[model samples]
Target: MKSTLKKLLPFAVVGVMSGATTVGALQYFNHDSNNTDQSYFTKASNVSFAGMNSAAVGDDFVKAAKTTVPAVVTIKNYQSRTSSRASEQDMLDFFFGDPFGGKGQQRQRQQQTPDNMPSGMGSGVIISPDGYIISNNHVVAGANKLEVVLSNKKSYIATLIGTDPNTDISLLKIEEKGLPYLNFANSDNIEVGQWVLAVGNPLGLNSTVTAGIVSAKGRGIGILGSQGKAANPIESFIQTDAAINPGNSGGALVNTNGDLIGINSAIQSTTGYYQGYGFAVPANLARKIVEDIKNFGIVQRGFLGVTSLDLSDDQLVAAYNKQKNTNIKAGSGIYVTGFGESSGAEDAGLKLGDVITKIDNIAITDFADLSMAVGSKRPGDKVQVTYSRNGKDATTTVTLRDQKGGTATRTKADLSVTEKIGAEFQSIDDKTKAYYGVNSGAVAKNVMEGSEMAKAGIVDGYIITEINGKPVNSQKDVENLLNKFSGTVQIKYLDDYGRGYQRGFKMP
Candidate 1:
């Protein structure tokens, strides 16, 4: 197991806005649009995987595969580089003339991607007959265009609805009705040892299905935050022995009755292939994310604002106890290490070293449990938190807040994208602007910790002269440019010392 841990690879096969008139680069949810459909999630109480006869196992697998195959799709991501201005192109060619010793060879290599070719391919599960689909955010990130191919070879140009990098879930839409779709089952009710089917277009094999039992639940593999892509990675995965590979991401993980229990996401392997361990995002969490995107344009993630250390490992607990001069037991609960700014936990009197035992009656034995319980809620939702402080049990009500530390509902129109990225920007003062030698720019007045910008190494006092290759003259310009597109955003700026820097992060 130690050797396997060393070789274990956590992979998912896969931030903010500012300003007035932000309208956002990514498309916001339109309440007036006809795509709204909340009926995709089935009642949690209705799903049960109990007392199945062993003799009927083959029949159950057949039934599940038959029901879900048609709803799964092959997603082809198409992206073409935006053409640079000819003058800028010429200047580059003139200055750095083909390092390969052939005229324009370097330039050609830079722009070698054919416009008609797909940049990446993965799978998606249709959740609504009106053409709402759910897939992994990594599957469709940075695509200039998305094409969805159904089982029957029917294709449609898909539109990205919204994405939650924290959960690795993305919502997509296509123009068609009366299509086969999957209903979200109560993932909370799924049990280990119960049979589940992994259905997707793995390795470009369309409409493929593999069978396995649920090996574990509430498992955190730390896959989403592997590269700091997700500042607040919410990873409570349903682990299975199913054979999920590169293309299985964003695909369906369903139960014997063909109810969608999870979305097949990451795999634990040494060679980047399935190695008997696979993980999926719980259907309940994915359902909440898509719904939030449908209703609010961005994920309405609620933050408890407390950072803590998981007490699941005995060795770590012993070391921590020795260091802190306390008898902290392993598997007792997560111990609070610190609190974020405007933290509800701190305000509710949760002190450092408090062991969080439960949230609203749900056991908080590990980070996964804590994440799911809190990750499922939105800002302003109150949770009863039970904790042990100095071996004394106490309860408190914690009202969650959005990343911006507000309890108000967040909509694209009301929140600046800049604020979403964990930074607040203002037009640079003329002196600072002249010092940086930029005609137009915004000063990063504040950069929130653990935000996408902060993760990208952006700091306060950075002069943002360009974003997504467009000039940003004012806070409003920053807002407008950010709202103009979705996916990865490139930023060029200058440090407080006037040294130039460039950074990029995925748009939240």
Candidate 2:
């Protein structure tokens, strides 16, 4: 027998266990009919509930689990046999902690099965009475079909509404109405040691409930960054000691009153099984993402447009002070490193050596605090930023902007197919087209990280001559060709070095 153990990274092996499954490339869908009102979930109090401070704080696990179990459903991921093989490679990379891992060895665990059979299983929480469900993006990323199974064993085919890779949340909908759902609790009010329940279908067990306490909050475990944009992964996980296992990915983390406080996401384990640590996405941030996807067809994330160094690291602070000949103290707050293009922080008079202390009166002691504060807002939303410069406190109101530095709120209709695919194109020059021996071509000007194009290995400077067998000479041509495609789309392109290649990705 061969040993299956692989080298684990030093940063605590994190397993995205969706119940012994294979994840695939993500496909996004934006349909007008699937859009719903933003007021689907009932809001809970931001302050403590009526019996939060009572002596019997954790004695009502039975009631809480009973109320929430019906709302938590099992999600099955079904992928066609013909989808790109890249998803298999990605899954291997996710499990083994290697980009090019498991290439030579054939996958022996997953045997060939019918396309109708589910390839993976996880859990989801119903947020609306009309069959709207919320689950982790990894749970249903590469599925050709999705099925939602209720606690009563009733199954319904689900439609993918929208997804936010940055937050690792995806929304699904069924045609049924008058379904049981969970209310959203203000996760910001949750404290350490508070009683909570993890309701999900873990290890193929349906309607399993586990009790635990909030061990920590605002934990950045570097989990979402592996699946999302490395530079902009919004990970302020609610750390809990719940026994969340493989099938609990998108399940509900509820309070004693059955109010949803977070979504169980990842577990810190080396064997891909639940150990002692589990993480959940706070309900406050998840609610914002759900509302954005429901109303705007995409997340309205705001960016402060400046990178910073954590002042908590004494050595890093000392090195920076020595390099710059400045007496910067090591303490709370993040020291500004640089500004992004068209930065709102720069426009608001924030400079590189300034230390950000607060955002909208909320304390910003580290990147987790800063990420949660800004990641929950929309573009054009203004935040009062308090910072320290030369040991003097100053305040400035920053008008937050989008990734492109725009302040306007954009809807799904505002984005072209090329943008949705995660890239922008520019018409190739006549000389360039002649050199490539093509009559018409377009160069990928900008490629968004963690996008379909990026997943398909498309990068900046790649010249695309055809999309879905149609000639693409300009940006408009690319969009027109892609818009007409529904399912897998094939592309004929040349890399930045003029090497020819072909790729395919699914679209809906």
Give lDDT per model, in order: 0.77, 0.78
Predicted candidate 2 versus true structure: per-residue lDDT over 1-508, tens digit per residue: 1232333321113323321231210112112211111111112223121211222433588789889999999998886443335445433442343344554124422443575678678899999999999998877766768899999999999999987777878899998889999999999999999889999987666898877789899987766665334347888999887677677889999999999999998877643455467889999999999999999987898999998888977998899889978887889998998999999999999998999999989898887888999989999999999999988999999999998999999997777797678888988789999897777788886676546787667777888877877788888887777785679987777766666555678873
lDDT value, candidate 2, whole model: 0.78
Least accurate 10 contiguous residues by lDDT in model 2 = 33-42
Total backbone collisions for each predicted model = 15, 0
TM-score result, candidate 2: 0.74
Candidate 1 residue lDDT tens string, 1-508: 9765444322111001111111231123222212111111112322223222232366788899999999999998876543444224433433343344664444644675676678778889999999999998877766768999999999999999988778988999999999999999999999999999999876555787877789899998776776445768898999887767667888999999999999988877653445467889999999999999999887888989998888986887788888989886687688998999999989999999899999999899888888899989999999999999877999999999987789888786676787678787878677877766777688776665445676555677777778877888787787788874689988877766665555578887
| Model 2: per-residue Cα lDDT at residue 48 | 23
lDDT of 1 at 448: 51
**Model 1 residue 398 lDDT?**
98
What residue runs in model 1 are displaced by over 4 Å at the alpha carbon?
1-56, 81-112, 314-329, 420-463, 466-508
RMSD in Å for model 2: 12.9
